[model samples]
Target: MKPLADRIALVTGASRGIGRAIAVRLAQDGALVGIHYRAERDKAEQTLDDIRAAGGDGFLIAADLADPAGATQLSEALIAELRARRDPPQFDILVNNAGIDDRKTIEQVTEADFDRMLQINFKSPFFLIQKLLPVIADGGRIINISSMASRLSFPTMPVYAPTKAALSTLSRVLAAHLGPRGITVNAVLPGATSTDLNPLSDPARAAAVRDSVALGRIAGPEDIAPVVAFLASKEGGWITGETIEASGGQRL
Candidate 1:
């Protein structure tokens, strides 16, 4: 049987990029996926189709994580769907992959911009866990998608990294708090990945990032998804409260 057979997974921001890859990977491992998207319903439908093509079952959910009401809407929709299936309204895996980033320096960053990033990147995940804890199955996995920026001190872009740092810290705390319930909370940090959010369009910049990595290449979404899939499996039960970097040995 597959590692996550008979399990249910919900991946936020699953319309594209790393979130989409993780959703597909979890589905491939035999989990019924809830593909959550904010505005890209078409892309989300495509993801669901891909899951079905891979012989997995999945559906789409819409929620703008930046908004508090969106979180409630998603939870209610998820509960209703689970009930329709005659299964308990419980999820076996929750991948907090939805986030936003700002490439602004301290001087350039405005309060609104900072709040927006924090809302989507940090606050959303915080409340998501608060609201979903009861529905999350015991022994379930809570995987937060973090970034290497939390560790690397880039010259500018100050605001984005701290939000990720907050998420990593949250993961550790949740891991400790939820351990008694058999829930494992962890974070995955990816570096210089080839995603829409972090494009490699500039040849010079791309080559510089590539040279910094031991693997000598930018990681694709495919490279990061399997690590998350592993974390959601039985083998990763003992691993919690850790931030695992799947960064192709970048900045090591």
Candidate 2:
């Protein structure tokens, strides 16, 4: 039997990039995925199509994580979908991968920028987990897609880095809170991946990035997906409250 033959997984920001890769990987491992998108319906559909093409199954969910009410909206949609499918309210995996990045220096930061960053990157995930706790199956997995910026300082990512740091801290706290139930909560920090969010379109900049990595190359989203898939599998049950950095030893 497949390791995740009967599992259910929700991956936010799954319309593209790292989230899309993670969602597809989970489906490949036998999970029925819930692919969440904020505004990119077409991209979300493409993700579902990829899942189907791989002989896996999935559905699409839409919710704007930037809004204060977004978490509630997403949870309601998920529960409603499960009910419509005549399945139980519980699911096996939650991947909090939806987030935004503001490439502004501290001097350029404004109140609106800070609030929006906090709302989408940290607050939404926090409350989403709170709202879904009741339905998250015991022995389940919660994987937060954090960033290497949370640990390494980047002057251009002042606000974005902190938000990811908060998420990583939340993972640690929740792991202990949910430990007795046998659930595992973890944070995955991917460094300089070749996603739309971190485009490597500029040859010079891409080369600079590649040279910095100990692996001598920039990572693709596929490189990070397996890490998340492992964390979501039954084999990953014993691990919790940990931050797994898939950075290819950049700057090490």
Candidate 3:
């Protein structure tokens, strides 16, 4: 399973949820995972520590993708940091998984919410990928964390879904542009996963949501991690510009 052994992977939003799971899974798969977090230093370190406990190599990086300056600094710092490592990591994998959720009614949706969603989820990935594209090895992989909401639209999810859609679009274009260089780009659309955002400890809402899924359970980040690892590996080298849904049969 060391398909990615010696590979260096940078996963944004590695502090928790699906992103954290992806980071740990990639580490287990033998990649030197770079754990990225915005402000959750404690959580990020925990991810790195878990990798160490498992005998895998890892390092922690702090990056605020929500701000343009921070995104630029984060990208540059990663390149600089990886360059300083022993083998000077070429960063074969880039998982653009960092994002934010804005829950608001149609009328309640303000300009600020829209701006923040696009900034972190859409714009940040756009620029970060551009900056990191050169460093990604030929035939490398890029997986963008999108949402099932991109296709399953709802009233309060207008802005969020649009952001995911834009990200998917970006993934497709990058796949085409980078394909000549042998890079693969794709998106993963997840359903209602058991994340901090879901307040799973709250039985009422949790029950209601679980009942909605055909699996009768909400997915955990663990449920989504292996697929990401597979896509990042040579096994998924053939898949590019694809949107693989990791939902637990929740609705459509």
Candidate number with greatest lDDT: 2
For model 2, the superposed segments whose C-alpha errors exceed 4 Å read: none
How many backbone clashes are present in model 3?
1
Reference-based lDDT, each prediction: 0.92, 0.95, 0.88
lDDT of 2 by residue, 1-252 (tens): 888988889999999999999999999999999999998899999999999999999999999999999999999999887777645678889999999998999999999999999999999999999999988998999999999999998999999999999999999999999999999999999999998878899999999989999999999999999999999988888899999999999878
Ranking by TM-score: 2, 1, 3
**Model 1, span 31-87: residue lDDT tens:** 999999999899999999988998998989998888867778888888887887646
| Deviating ranges (above 4 Å) for candidate 1 | none
Residue pairs in collision within model 2:
none
> Who is ahead in TM-score, 1 or 2?
2
TM-score of each: 0.98, 0.98, 0.95
What is candidate 3's lDDT per residue for 1-252, written digit by digit as tens?
588897899999998888889999999999998888988799999888888898898888887888877678778888887789745447899999999888787799889888889999999999989888778888899999999999986788879999999999889998999999989999999988888766578889888878878887889999999999999988899999999888888884
